[model samples]
Target: MRRHRRAKIVATVGPASAAPDKLRALFLAGVDTFRLNFSHGLQEDHARVHAAIRALEQEVGRPIGILQDLQGPKIRIGTVKDGRLDLTAGETVRFVLDGSEGDKQAIPLCHPEIFAAAAPGQDLLIDDGRIRVRVVGLDADTLTAEVITGGPVSNRKGVNLPGTLLDLSPLTPKDRADLAFGLELGVDWVALSFVQKPSDVVEARALIGNRAGILSKIEKPQALERIGDIIRLSDAVMVARGDLGVEIPHEDVPGRQKELIRACRLAAKPVVVATQMLDSMVAAPAPTRAEASDVATAIYDGADAVMLSAESATGQYPVEAVTMMDRIIRSVEGHKLYRSIIATSDPGEEETPPHAVASATATLAEAVQASAIVTYTTSGTTTARVARKRPAVPILALTPHLATARRLCLMWGAHSVHTDDVDSYEEMTTKAADCAVQEEFARSSDLIVTTAGIPFQMAGNTNNIRVIQIQ
Candidate 1:
């Protein structure tokens, strides 16, 4: 099937939309990909979803991508004895790491690493900031805290420490197991949540190997601090606005989203803007006007995909949400500004090697009226940079890395092909032309634009460019 919308729609699956029939309906409603949140679903549930997606792909006669989102190191308070507690502002609370358990006055802190890392005066947000506390004292057995802001605290509530760095690894055992399971299922993409540094991507890649593409969720401020490195290392990126909005100032999210998208575009890595795109649809059949504008903005900003969180997974109007997002993307893409926004570039004064090559390729594509632009990328940087230019013709990205292929599935106007990396420029150009013809992106006589580097450098080392006729 030909994609009608420039920006893809990624719908999450949950109890409300997990059935095969419902999944089929969603696929028909214009959901290009299905997201399986490993955090909530069991292994059996994932298997069922996987089977359903495969069945639908066959029925629809189109490749439908499946993204398995791994729940990385999720920090939460242990179970509360009473199931719920009310804390008044300025009230002192004590969190003890004692395994003894059970208490009406205090909650058990099972994460000793958290206690060791937290310092006095640091802020702790519990349950998405429903309850806020400040560390008052630290001890061997207990850590004292005072309620800075009061609200209802429930069992196993999530804990967020913004400034306080935790002394825990990014990937938990559960995430590792989930990665293996996702690979076994042949999932197209695996999204790693709460990625803090570039090393997280490296580790996940080592485990996943080439089984699937890794899409790092940029929800932590630490990730933003190391975004350039993370983008360089990751296959793709997701601007996970849910936790990100909570971690950083709410006003900063828009700028951060734009910055991340721009960076990914320059690197040619596909970026997805996720979370709460049509949240109101969880209850209502339609989205709010603001939500509609939000989705449109992402499309205009040249995001590869706009993701639906609970709106599609557990909302009553899952199908409607996907349909709405598809409509909005199509409508916005029709505008001249949409393409203009994507093609616009901010080439720094002293251009980096990747940037210089990307700019040259874009210029050559425009000048030659190329039937297609073929990019050889290892880490997806060159592909993303070329995509940001938004050439009128198709962009065929050939990567030896399967992770890059799956991750590029979300990119606007990009068709990723998995192939072996060539050692020389001539081999790279010939192979790229062959791929373009095989994919029907270019005819035998059509001109094609190709980009790569000499001496067979790493994935992002795109320092050469050529225009060749397909034969």
Candidate 2:
């Protein structure tokens, strides 16, 4: 199906929307990708959902993307006295590397990485920053801190060390197992969480090995410090604002989101703005105005996709949430100021032949008011480059590889079609025009722009651009 909006929607599948009929409804409501969160549900649950999605894909005759989001290392305090502890602002709390339950005087924090990496004056936020503490002293096995913001600390509350970089892998043992299961299920995208450095992405890439697209979730402050390297290494990026807001100043998130989006655009990689796009929709039928504005802002910033977490996973109105997001994107893109805003924020083309050709194709298509920009892509690179320009016309990406078509579902403005590989220029032109007509992207006598590499079926060699008029 051809989406009216350029930006895509990613919906998480859970108990609320796990049935085949619900999945199909979500897809029809404009969900381009489905996210399977390993943080919850069993492997068998995900397998069933995966099977249903594949069936839906065949039924609709469209490529649908599936993203497996790994639950990375989670550091949390051990059991507390009476299941909770009430702390005062000036009270001193002692945290020890023990598994035994204790009172406020000696709270057990089982994670050793936090104790080893934490230093005096570094802040420790618990329960999503509801209770804050700053370390004042530390020993080999214990960390003493005074409460900066006092609150009721409960058992197993999550810990966030914004100022310290723990020597830990983003992929936990469970994540590795989950990754294996997802790869076996043939997922199109793998979202690596808790990415603190570039090495985290490298480690994931080693296991992924081109089987799936590696998307790094930028939710840690340390990741932002080395974002350039992280973005360069990963196939795509996600502005994970939920945990990110807890780690950094809430005011800094919008600027960081824009920076990450621009960086991904420069690299011609897909970027998703995730976490609570329509949070209130989890309970309410419609989203709050602020939530709608939030989704529009991401689209205006040129985000490739906006995602729904709990809003679609366990929400009361999962299909309505996707429909609302789709409507918001269409409205924002149709606004008179959108084109100018996107043009102003353009990262421009890189100094490469492929990039030059892609940029020229976009420019020429707009100059001629072409009906569509048809791209003959083997590795989806040529289509991605054209999408990065955010052209006015639609983009029809024809590729022989179904994986390429599925991966391109997350890219902005690219409607992917899995077609047979063309061997010559004549075949390429004929196939592009035929697919455009078949896909309802063009009609007889309509002008269209086509781009491809000279060597057929070779990846990343976009050195040719052609303008054709359908007969």
Candidate 3:
């Protein structure tokens, strides 16, 4: 369904709200996209949510996007000997990866690769950094560590290496299976978690094969380092603040979040601000003023979407959370500064390739009074770049990736269409104009802004810009 506010709301579906009726209420409450966290629900449960979303789309007479978030490689300690281990500060604990039978003295570290790359003095955060430990010694099968902080560590507690580069891929075996299933279900978007580099995006895209758009979750510090490359590769970007906050300095997260949104906006990629927006709403009907301000800031920053995690998935007030988020977005969007904040960006020192193309498209769109701007993007980079310009017309993004289309749902003034890639710029523009007219998205008399590369090469190869009349 078409959202009234420029920024969109993305609600997670979980046990608290998965039924068709409940989902319909969420949609009515103003959820533009539905996020199915593969980390929690079963495939059958996801199928039900998918069906409900499709049904609701029909009922509402508008396309609703579905994002299937893959549970990426999550390294965790195996079952504890007594189901829980309490470590007192200054106590030494050993993390072993030996195939030896489970014992109370040493816990089985599922990821030995972590030890190979880890160094002494590196901090290891367990269970969301609840239990802090420092690497003391390294061995083939065991990592000796002294507990720096005392806490109860339970079964399958997650392990986080903040700065250390673990010798492990982002995708796990389970993620591959989930990706296959998501493709079979024809999901609109697939979110890859814990993305450390641009190569991760390429590998996932190769597997997805244009089935769905890829939204790389920028959570780890490594990801922040390679953001420009990742943005060039990924279809969209998600500021996953949960793990991000855990990985980086908490205070730095706010500035990083704004930076990411601006980067995506400059690239015209849809950026979603996710995690803990209404955390208190998980149990309370009302959100704290801080939470409201957090959401308003995202909207004010011109983020394409603000996401809810536990607030809607397992929260006591799922509907209310969505309602509140919707109200906050609407309120923030009403402010004249909202559009200005979204439009205002650091002026480019020079016209880069994508920036030059985007500036040209915006100028042409205004000059020709175009009804729409049609962007053909392979990795959705060119599309995002154009969107950053925030032209005074609808942007029709045509991509071969479904995930890109779904992700674009959150972008300002963007309407995504799934289409096969064109081999030539001429074909791409003509087809875009034809689709715009055929779908009644634009009229034959309407001028259309078109941008693409001459040869339709790699991602970020946006060099062409034109204004054409729809026929």
The C-alpha TM-scores of every prediction are: 0.84, 0.98, 0.83
Number of the candidate with higher lDDT, 1 or 2 = 2
Q: lDDT score of model 3?
A: 0.82
Index of the highest-lDDT prediction: 2
The 10 consecutive residues of candidate 2 with the worst lDDT sum are 97-106
Point to the candidate with the largest TM-score: 2
Per-residue CA lDDT of model 2 for 1-471, tens digit only, reads: 789989999999999999999999999999999999999999999999999999999999999999999999978898987898999999899999975777877899988898888989999999989999999999889999999999998888999999578999999999999999999999999999889999999999999999999999999999999999999999999999989999999999999999999999999999999998899999999999999999999999999999999989999999999999999999999999999999999997799989999999999999999999999888899999999999999999999999999999999999999999888899999999999999999999999999998898779999998999999
Extract clashing residue pairs from model 3: 212-403, 213-403, 213-404, 267-384, 267-385, 268-384, 268-385, 269-384
Write the residue-wise lDDT of candidate 1 on 63-82 in tens digits: 67889998888887787766
Arrange candidates by lDDT, descending.
Answer: 2, 3, 1
How much is the lDDT of residue 21 in candidate 1?
A: 93
Relative to the true structure, candidate 1 has a C-alpha RMSD (angstroms) of 4.0
Candidate with more favorable, higher lDDT: 1 or 3: 3
Better of 1 and 3 by TM-score: 1
Task: Candidate 3: list runs displaced more than 4 Å.
Answer: 98-104, 346-385, 391-407, 415-471
